[model samples]
Target: MYAIIGATGHIGNRVTDILLNKGEKVRVIGRDAARLQQYVNRGAVPAVGDLKDTAFLTTAFQGATAVFAMIPPSYTASTFRAYQDVVGISIATAILDVGVTHVVNLSSQGAELPRGTGPIVGLHDQEERLDVLRGVNVLHLRPTYFMENLLANVPVIHDYGYAGSAVRGDIKFAMIATADIAERVAAHLLARDFSGSSHEDLLGQRDLSLQEAFTIIGRRIGISDLVYRQIPYDEFEQALLGTGMSRDVCRLFVEMSEALNRGLFAVNRPRNAATTTPTSIEQFAEVFAEVYRGAQHRHAA
Candidate 1:
């Protein structure tokens, strides 16, 4: 059996769906029983509890051959660093106690870097903690910026006519679709194959400037004059608030954006020919229009 923690989340849901469609038995862990009921209806066995609870995770990991592990950001904390420490400890302890053999962790690219590594530094700590596990094999799937990030700005795109960020208009940064990430995770978990302590950089077809991405969005949504504004770092708090994110989360996002502008988010050492899986931003946009947007509408209703 394959287990997915945070199964109700965006990437987790996608992972469960893919695994189930392939006739894999999936155990989905979630804190909210009500929320988990949706997955139960879809043939996923719901394991309900907090991921921070090692006992809960131990039970959830029972009979699972491989697990998809991830830590969701807790912006309610005073700082991102604190949140990272808490999340890292929780996930690492669970992995150690669960006795699961293979783990596919959701991490950000550039997380392996040392101090001053920006928002990804916490993810760095998680990878480090897992490295000490004695027998289990771990795969750190470090993906670039998620396509779902744009969905948070749907209101801004529709009403305000623009997508704003601190990134340069032509920075040509990598972006990956969450569905692609989920697909890769499902593939690895099903095979029970671990290629040692490897990190997979899930890159999109190519790098795209914020301006260029917005242009594609404009064409797809039938808004020719759509724009991407490069806002100042200090203003990101307010700007993100305008987009409906909490103030604390917005501040962390500002830190991430500033880091991105400084090139902290760019991928280095492209994957070798042996393990490259590239998805184009344009192809991802089509799915955004079809799958994710429709899901969003249903959620809103």
Candidate 2:
């Protein structure tokens, strides 16, 4: 049996879908029973509970041959790192207690750095804690910047005819689709080819700059003049804070952008065939345009 945390989320949902299609028994763990109903109907055992509750996670993880784990994003947390640590520690403890033999952890590319990587520091901590488990084989899947993150700019694109961020328009880096990440995770969970604790970096089809990304998106959406502006760090932070993000999360996001601009994420990491995926910017642009049009129609209604 496979146990999946964050089962209703983008990555988890795809993971569960693939597993169920392959005729594997799946147990899904999430906080909302209503959201998990679809998976339950499809033959997954639903385990609804808080991630921080060790007892809940222990019970959910029990009797599973392997598990997919992640710390769900919490924008409302008073302190981002503290919240990540609590969730991370709880997951590690439960995996150990339940004696699950294999685990695939969702991590980020910058998790190799000890500090200055903002929210990714928490993932680094998770890797370290989970690595010490004696009987468990852990594989940390480190994916680059998610292309879906562009969805956050939909409102700004609609209102201002542009998208903006603290990142410079010219800095090129690997960006991946969450679907691709899910594919790799499901493959690993099924094969169990990896032993001991290790990590693999999932870089998308190619590297791209924010300007190039926006150009592709604009072309797809029929906006010939759409622009991507690099907002000042302070202004970006203020905007996120205004959106109800806690101070710590706002600061961490800014730090993460700064780190990306500095080329910190790619340090010592070289892209190879193993890290490259199949999705391209043009492919994802179509998906983005579809979502943008849906949002536009909803607003017009």
TM-score of 1: 0.89
Candidate 1, 277: how far from true, in Å? 3.6
Worst 10 residues of 2 by lDDT: 261-270
State in Å the error of residue 198, model 2: 0.7
Cα-based RMSD of candidate 2: 1.0
RMSD of each: 3.0, 1.0
For model 1, the superposed segments whose C-alpha errors exceed 4 Å read 241-248, 267-278, 287-301
Model 2 regions lying over 4 Å from their true place: 266-269
lDDT (tens digit, per residue) of candidate 1 on 109-175 = 7787765555577888888888788787999998888877766556666556688766677677778
TM-score (C-alpha) between model 2 and the true structure: 0.98
lDDT of 1: 0.76
RMSD (CA, Å), candidate 1 to true, equals 3.0
